[model samples]
Target chain A: MKREDLQLLQKREWCKGCGICVAFCPTKVLIIDTDDKVTIANEDACIKCRQCEQRCPDYAIFLEEASDV
Target chain B: MRSSQLVEKYFRTKNLPHIWCPGCSLGIATRSLVVAIDELGLDKNKTVIVSGIGCSSRAVGYLDFNTIHTTHGRALAFATGVKLANPELHVIVISGDGDASAIGGNHLIHAARRNIDLTLLIFNNNIYGMTGGQFSPTTPHAALGTTAPFGVVEQPFDLVKLAEGAGATYVARGTAFHVNPLVKYYKNAIEHKGFSMVETICICPTYYGRQNKSGTAVQMMHWLKDSFVLNTAYDKMPEEKRQGKHVYGEFVKKDLPEYVEEYVGIIERLKGEEDA
Candidate 1:
């Protein structure tokens, strides 16, 4: 997702596409693509709840605080 | 070379690409422990990780803390000594079902009975992963393992009940799919003053999964999502409806005088009497 707003730092290599983050997201911000990799579907709809960051099994998702530049 | 900032800080990045097979839930379990420690803001210098010989015990090498990789079934003994020698240290034990319940079961019970100040995180994968998929003490009845090709006939030990019966001040259970809840349990366990035990229902995708046909790692994760029921929710359901459901929740939490604290008190009092 875009860093100007609420950004998510993802180390995709660690990701096993467990789909826990995609399902746990409130705003439906992520999706497991056809290749079984997570993709940001709606960046602006993201609420930065940190649910995904907390629940991901592989520690693939990292939520960065929104920086006002 | 570390890509993740959190990993760089807490884990040995040089040990990147851990030995655990892909889709193994151990990483998630270890992550919860790290997250709990971070949330608690525990001083790394004063923290110690004691582990036994098993796949779950591999966490000691990657964790950036005072760690002891002890022999089979001896992690609890080593951790007890480490805690008694330095009461200031936060001793954490991470072990598998076989290492903790099968071989080290006595140490576990006595430690909890003593109400020692230590957090024991038992990774209950059901089967012994590193030991060629033998049925462990926590393995579900009739579950398939290498040693039990026709399925296990013996019943599994309920860890939460055992810990509570043995006098642990804090006891909780959580699954790998419920990482947030696992982190909360771990955080609470770490903060607990007396002996604390958190049984993590982890997924062993390599040996157990392949042998039992439990599905791929992702599917196993989804199975956990579908199966786990919190104790609160279970209480709300009808008794018959709760059958076959694995309940995960904080079963007990009480403030008890920790063994370490009490032992130190006795030492000071005896020393004073001798001086007098």
Candidate 2:
């Protein structure tokens, strides 16, 4: 799936700011925000590979097929 | 398609925000198993999750399925009874490095030797995380643990090698960083009809990390990515260079008759002979 066609969902409370997702994300789409939680720093660059989802030990982040709001 | 949906569909919602320490890779490994089970379209009622004592053993309580939370180091024994009684259940045993390789070492080998139809997932964090960071059978030599203040002197178990040597029909190794491949191995292990095991290298920041002076959770994850070589590439590395490195991949997959099947065959033959 294309990055533009995906929505990144972050459960901020569950994130411990472990950057395994960032290390695996080929697109550099994620960053540990000031709060020590994962954030989509580059939404447009996301490749929708779901590496973040797969690597998240917290079950804190995921990708969903974008739904019309 | 939604994160909440994944959680609600596959997990027992009330039991989560699981008590696992933040950055513990047990959650990551558990999710891979969940994904494998979901993708396989297995019947939840017929699937059983069995676990023995340890941090990883707590997974049975969280996963939404028929689960057996057995005593320390005896999960395989309990699971064996469960599988033999029903023979139709998909039994999966989740155990810690200490629980599976130390106290339960005998059961682990015998189950594999018998070629039982079960998926034995070893959540190997090297140290005994739940028990105040004691050194486990899989702890790397010289790694610090609460019990090994002077640095561990004994050799560690090569878990995949042990499983293979014990006659497991399918054996694989995966680290927490390699999530997708880990999930694939979980799926294949579950599908295999004989004794199958996947040793998942996990990060225990609260124990192994602190004792070893390993960096933060993120850094530990990077270490996991670095410390293991794929089985294919490991073959070419010289013997000296291969020391302290793990080889991750499926070591074996064979079409072998499972324990339950052989037992049932004997039962059927006995019945026929009695009639004659």
RMSD values for the candidates in order, in angstroms, are 3.0, 2.1
Tens digit of lDDT per residue, candidate 1, span B118-198? 999998888898877989988888999888999999999999999999999999999987888899999999999999999
| Fnat for every candidate | 0.29, 0.51
For candidate 1, write residues A1-69 as lDDT tens digits.
554455776767766776767876889999988877778888788887877776665667777643411
> On a 0 to 100 scale, what is the lDDT of residue B215 in model 2?
85
Q: Residues B129-199, candidate 2: write the lDDT tens digits.
A: 88889999998888898889998999999888898899999999999888888989999999999999999
- TM-scores of the candidates are 0.89, 0.94
> Which 10 successive residues of model 2 chain B have the least lDDT summed?
B1-10
lDDT of 1: 0.86
The CA lDDT at B112 in model 2 is: 93
DockQ of every predicted complex: 0.33, 0.52
CA RMSD (A), model 1: 3.0
Off by over 4 Å in 1: A1-4, A15-52, A65-69
Against the true structure, what is model 1's DockQ? 0.33
In candidate 1, list every pair of residues with a backbone clash: none
